[model samples]
Target: MARIAFILLCHKNPDAIIRQAEQLTAAGDCIAVHFDASADAADYNAILNGLQDNPNVTFAKKRVKCGWGEWSLVQATLNAVEAAVEAFPHASHFYMVSGDCMPIKSAGFAHQFLDAHDCDFIESYDFFDSNWIKTGFREERLIYRHFFNERTQKRRFYWGLALQQRLGLRRKIPEDLQIMIGSQWWCLRRRTIEALLDFVQERRDVMRFFQRTWIPDETFFQTLVRHLVPGREIECRTLTFLMFTDYGMPVTFYNDHYDLLLGQDALFARKISVEASQLHERLGGLYASDQMEFEISNEGRTLFQFLTGRGRVGRRFAQRFWEQETTLGRNRELMIIACKKWHVAKRLVAGIRDHTNVPAVEYLFNEEDAALPDLGGIETTLEKRSRHRRALMRMIFDHFESDRLIICLDPSSLDLMSDFFADRATVRLLEISCSFDDDYLAGHARRVGLAGPQTGADTMARLLPTIRHDMVYERDMMRDADFPNMTRISDTGSVDANAHAIAQFLGVSLETGKTLAETPHLFVD
Candidate 1:
């Protein structure tokens, strides 16, 4: 499948944004989105919650303070473009669209359309002839100083205009660059975008001049397309259809406009309102998913349509980022349970993740472990009981599920095996033991970023296994640690030998499963 990177700029209505993202996305396709800096916290979190299922979607880490009809809009769009480029290395074609935009055709059709074309699809026309800025008035865009804070900046605009009218104080457009204007949207090839990004980086003087220009985004990419990549294929038409009024603002599409939109040969349609339920239903009915997404369509359309009307956001199902990210389901191959022995537990979890990366959870049983719930000042016995042990079990059951080897570090956790076995959290619960060298001290562990203030007896690692473990790893003094794991691993071949023992205990060969093959990487500093 061809990789396409989608950069979507959104301010409100995360439901519509989520719908648009899901429809445009498939395997190997990535979506990069930038929410307006002033966007509501709940709405922003809703967007993240909605897209949590899609690993391909990435948000800009640095948000741009967007201002409408000013340079900040372009800045936010540029940030989204840069983020997409950084995140999706496989993406070759880049599509920049708006949050209100929706795919009118199948994803395959859009993919095939881009695959058939070799050049970028950015449309532009000479600003002098387009009449978008009234021919002779086109120069007003470059000469005027448009302030980003639109409300209070109105007086500044008028004052600047008066100053220019009286004293010719307006800024001059660069002599080397020609201004162009068109539909402020495009689908471009990767090389063209990278070149454009590099051009902006090299020519900040041009950006500084344009930052004060009226609606710079209107002229920014359009001018660059003409100046930087001349003689390239220009479509001169946007993929999104928008009907405009005499005043030059886009008219809202209603149910009546659905037929017209369906007949048009475009990939997307913009500014659809949720109040027009029939329109959304018709659109979803036409472009549904492969697995018969009528239900998804109905749910998404219902929520989107309702939200579009009042701008109230809702997801039928939602969870916090970590909760949604690490939720477990059985019918898998391996499950990791890391309790109090955080040192060995951390390493073993890393080893399993490196080998298979199957579903796993690293539960810290030690009250000393930072992951454990806080036990701050409980006066009553019930309160004390609820704070430490009860909360941990509740958390464990909530995140627990697996079909493979369960590596539990704390023996106290093994006492709750009946709780897990009842839920079938795993097909089989394996007892694993960890033993560190006697020479190892708590101070040594502290130097390596582990928790401090211990007498270094370290009986927990050796004693936990004897109670219930079926396999024990006699981890010799640490030496060969993975760079990601951040421990110096031994070069004396003890790790390989320990891996061999693990394989032997499991009744599997070192050559049979990737588990042993991947063991060294966990400690291969």
Candidate 2:
């Protein structure tokens, strides 16, 4: 068991601070708390009383009156380290977090991940580069003098710092030292923390220089580490996901951010508030688990699964497919179910239905297809792979029973259509793309990892001629006038929106200018 020493730098959210402290406190993984001295004394004493009985939890003896962009924040972090070192000397790693930050990954997974790779997880970027953030953030933070004290209301800003920089009044950096900037939150080795403590003690001048600097917390420790090591990228990116506002302050998260939280691979997220207490509660339960089932499942989750879940994407596609099949399938002439180019299929079905109405369409992909993606590399057994394909065939055929059947297919869908559907029916391939240029199709194709322009063009050349005898409609979405007596449609606009010439091809006519908002879908099957 590789136990960690966790330090929390907290200022607000008393309930969140108490919960996180209790959650991270375990037998081997010790937790140390440092509530800002500026906070209410009663709140501080209440937290101390709550955690005092827990041997694994400790409190900072020297609480710093922390303020944003001030030295106090860094001082508080340093004090938390001193608290942790004293309480748990056998700790494997030292990690800093905030009161608002809640773990996304389980602590067991975190311990395993840290134990597997003995590398530092710190994010540091050069002051000279604009690659990480906008240039203005750097200029104001690094170039000029900045001083602010929230408690005492002391403030100072001097443009002379820039002029002095022009006249070379800047303090000389030793050739061995270089500056780097990064997020204040960091996880480091025992040796690294010791080294930083020693460096600060020895170089009071260097620490004082940073004291007058703007937002010193972000720059102080990161710059010192880079100055000491001089030219190596951070081994691990910071695990916390801090949503930033337009003003660059950390944005508070809520329930609306729950999906975004799921998508992120981070262990922790920041700036949570009372409004999103439900999010915090959910995250708390998740972090306590020993293993993450979703991590393994997420890798194999494909577009098919997302499509079937009737999520936002699935609902959009369902609504579009329904507009046509709702009317046309009832005629019993011939219906093709193709989802190879899912995005194009949506547009084509929606656009075609605008002019040609169809019956309620029924397309079925089972729980397995809707659950897993194309597992070409994953499922390598003939028996398993064969079974997977058959499952999909069963799903496709279960819907339409007719001699006339041509389904849209992708590499993930199936390899051979002749096996299940029977080749008796003449297959009329209706290939629809926004344009011959992959850039047009890329918006949709890229999601499934089939966005290569040159590759798509090459496939078109081979497949179109191979089935030349039965090919019916081979039209590039915006390029060709293959639909005689109809105007060409632009790929950029939505077909339902009456995209001028594009809508004309679909034969969608409104009452003068009422648009899709009024007539929407004209019934025609």
> How do all models score by TM-score?
0.52, 0.57
Candidate 2 local lDDT, 285-305, one digit each (tens): 766777554322121123223
Judge candidate 2 at residue 16 and give its lDDT. 65
lDDT of 1 by residue, 1-525 (tens): 557898899888888778767766753578999998888989989999999889789998878778767888889888989999998888888887786666666566667767777766666777777666643346777776665344558777677666777887778788888788877768888888899999999998999998888777888988887787755566666767665544556667778655445444566778787677777766654554432211111121222232233311331222333333332344433332432345555666566556553444454333332343343433124334323433333444445433344344443333233233333233333323344442343333334322223212333243223322221211211111111211221224465655564454334566533455345434322
- Model 2 gets an lDDT of 0.55
Alpha carbon lDDT at 322, candidate 2: 19
RMSD of each: 26.6, 18.0
* Most accurate candidate by TM-score: 2
Off by over 4 Å in 2: 133-155, 159-169, 229-233, 245-249, 256-260, 296-525
